[model samples]
Target: MPDASRITPPVVAPTEAPVNPVSMHIRLDPGMPLAHLESVYHAVNTEKNAQGIYQLTLQDAQVPANRDFELLWVPAPGNAPQAALFNEQWQGDEYALLMLMPPAPAPAGATARRVPREVIYVIDTSGSMHGDSIIQARAALKLALERLTTADRFNVIQFNHQTSALFSRAVAATADNLQRALSYVDRLVADGGTEMLPALQLALGQQPEQGVLRQIIFLTDGSVGNEQALFSLIHQQLGDSRLFTVGIGSAPNSFFMTRAAQFGRGTFTYIGKVAEVGEKMAALFSKLETPRLTDIEIHWPQDQPVEMWPARIPDLYLGEPVLVALKLQQPNLPLTLTGDAAGVPWQQQVTLRGGAARSGVHQLWARRKIADLMDQRAQGVAEPEVRKAVLDVALTHRLVSRYTSLVAVDKTPSRPADQGLENKALPTNLPQGWSATKVFGSLPQTATASEWNLLVGLLLLACGVLFSRWPGVGFGVRVGPVSDGKAHGGNVL
Candidate 1:
């Protein structure tokens, strides 16, 4: 055959490697128009697997400047004109899902009054947060202190190997106290191992002052490995106090920060760069000063079997809405949500009806269930049972979890039997406004291990080609030489 493969030679190397892929799952009202989005995201690989469920894969995804999803409603079957609930048929299923949005905040100059806050700032001074992390944290704490009014009482708690409080107890937000706090924060330095349990114990164990909104704002790089223990401590001691975690570093453990806040019945915030400290802290302060919706309870119809995630709802802050997901055996039931805003009773009710069948709703419910199970596991639930439950949910939904990961393998092996695979770590960028030299004591190299591997592969491939062309060289021809099967070349060994 005169070596047909040799007659039409393939290119051995690509000019550039492909970018990393980003995946997104979205659910909307079934049959909604998608032409506009298709045009905008032309390069994305998008497909609708089921009604109202879409999967999108894009290379090197970037955030859109304007992105929003507004829920669509349709008239319910046999629904009264005056009925408060509206429904759309679930696109592909028999079950109907109900949604209710809380009433909007009262207009400015309304009767609602701001609550007095008792604030405790918990800061981490671990060795990993030696430089830019500590600097930005101090700046953020100072800004928080400045936002305190005379009506507020405040304390500062910093932790490393041990914990210390700036005052014996939370003191009035007086001029003298504020200045002393500022000086105290300035003199703080980062050192020692992270021992967060003691800090959290001190912050939450204090007897809460009656009628005051108690909040603990925790700032840290979230580098500790013993997350389960900390979560247990927070749940045990978190009587009437809320713990809000502020992620502080170029890379923080997002899973820990988010789940900790969820368990603490509070919200989480992130300040990735020094410049964002002011903006984020200001927003947090606004939420702190506003009247919150508390003691939230959702009343489902007594007759039907209903399952809902997030058994306990967190208090709602200003401009925040309440969302819950549930699966019901029967339809056409009424759901009532009740809460208190500034001691004024507030309630909203919505009747259930078949809505456009959305694809990802089931998966969303599954994720929440898995998260709840994890929280239970952290709080002394049986390990084997919880692990099995989490694994089942994760595998069913094809979602990644601590125990399960998403992995792909090719059917065909491209490398020689003698070849060895190399692994490398990827390098992440420093946060904006942070100096590399200051953070690391010197400017560190930015090249990732993958880049080095690619370079070495190219060099070896070049050498192979040169050796193959030699007069006396004779080797069995393989179409591709790259371990990943993405490169085309003949192996010479």
Candidate 2:
């Protein structure tokens, strides 16, 4: 047997400043001798066991986000080319596992041709979106509108407490119409509650023109409480309309934005800084203009029982690959994928091969499963049942989720329960380009006609009550009986 004691841990310098604590684990194929372990960042702790699995924990900092896989594979004598494996368990159960990169772009003029698009821009102008948030949103919308061609149809919908469209229906992206849209977006102000449901309904309700790609680009801080409702609406009305979300704040609600885009079968973009608005929106426009891979399906070996997360595959943007984690009973099984690109059918097949054992793939898969379960809960699954399922998966994988959080407890108690606990809030810096006065000073104009209508309704109701009690008043005409004999002595007004 090869001596596992002879292996040496890699010596690597830290690549980047760590923003959050990260932990990683790697499991090698059974009977595979540990030749070496290498990483770009020094691991705070490294431990190897009899089962050929290695675990590493990084405290406070880890490798840079942009860096590729840390473990560099060194093939042993007569070893085949090895793909990367994050984590695995070798139990008696049968399952399947596979990972694949995005297919290369088809040869020039060989793939499906681009389709004309009908773009709808839905922007949130709620109170929380004041300052830099609204500014970035407006700039992004202008960029998208400028990219539309004359052959395309386009419209703009701005929502706060009420929803209003730039046009009653989508109009040709003429120069005049595009200019009008830019001006309309420029005049939008951040105020009122985030009424996204109505805006989404209006955008999705648009009739799809033949041969035109219907897409909705939504920009918001995602600061709404009714995220589930919006998600359900998107799922129900999605039809052929793809919804992309542009997160537009320093600390936007990422959970809502990411899942919404997933349900809408589109991609999500983040614009944390004003400078990134142009760059991010430009990238998004590229995806919008290109043909996307849709109706993707993966076929695994029939002999292997496979369990995968994100059971519903999302549409692939340009250069975006389909990634999934599977608990397989066997390794090195061949797989096939089929999908549609534009209007043409596309398919690919690959034979799985042994590769270098990487780390974190299992945890990534677990995170995806948890997200899917939560999405199901949002879609009306029983809360207790979904919570239980999520908790079991999270606890088994030791992941952080809505039902599970990583908490550190001290064995020795420093303070008694009777000492009482004091709550302190931490102050956060204002988002870049935001003004404190605008955000906190005076409230913007958010009052809507609904308030006036409510007052009028109350007044009318009171007047009716008074008139009923004092029939002598001439505020309303009263009839003692109906001429058609519908009523004998009933009062009518």
Candidate 2 achieves a global lDDT of: 0.69
Tens digit of per-residue lDDT, candidate 1, span 1-493: 1222221122111233323323454433434323223413224555666554565554335432111112222322221111132233332322333343334445677755767889999999876577678988999999999989899999999998889999999999999999999999999898766778888889998956789989999999876667788899988888888889998865666778888998888887776667778877887877767636678787976777767777887777643444566666556667777777667787766666634444566667668888899889777899999999999988877888879997888889788889999864443334333334333332124222356678899998998899789997655645666776444566443
Considering summed lDDT, which 10 consecutive residues are worst modelled in model 2? 1-10
Q: Which pairs clash in model 2?
A: 82-355, 83-355, 85-358, 94-329, 95-328, 95-329, 96-328
How many pairs of residues collide in model 2?
7
How many pairs of residues in model 1 come into backbone collision? 10
> Can you list the residue pairs that collide in candidate 1?
88-354, 88-355, 88-356, 89-355, 89-356, 90-355, 90-356, 90-357, 91-356, 91-357
Q: What are the TM-scores, per candidate, against the unseen true structure?
A: 0.68, 0.68
- What local lDDT score does residue 357 receive in model 1, on the 0 to 100 scale? 48
Question: Residue 304: error of model 1 in Å?
Answer: 0.9
Candidate 2 TM-score to native: 0.68
Off-target runs (Cα >4 Å) in candidate 2 are 1-87, 90-112, 341-345, 411-418, 423-426, 442-493
Give the Cα lDDT of each candidate.
Answer: 0.68, 0.69
Residue-level lDDT tens digits of model 2 in 184-248: 98899997656678999999987687878899999998767677788888877789888899988
- The runs of at least 3 residues in candidate 1 whose Cα sits more than 4 Å from the true structure, single-residue gaps closed, are 1-112, 130-132, 354-356, 395-398, 405-407, 412-414, 420-493
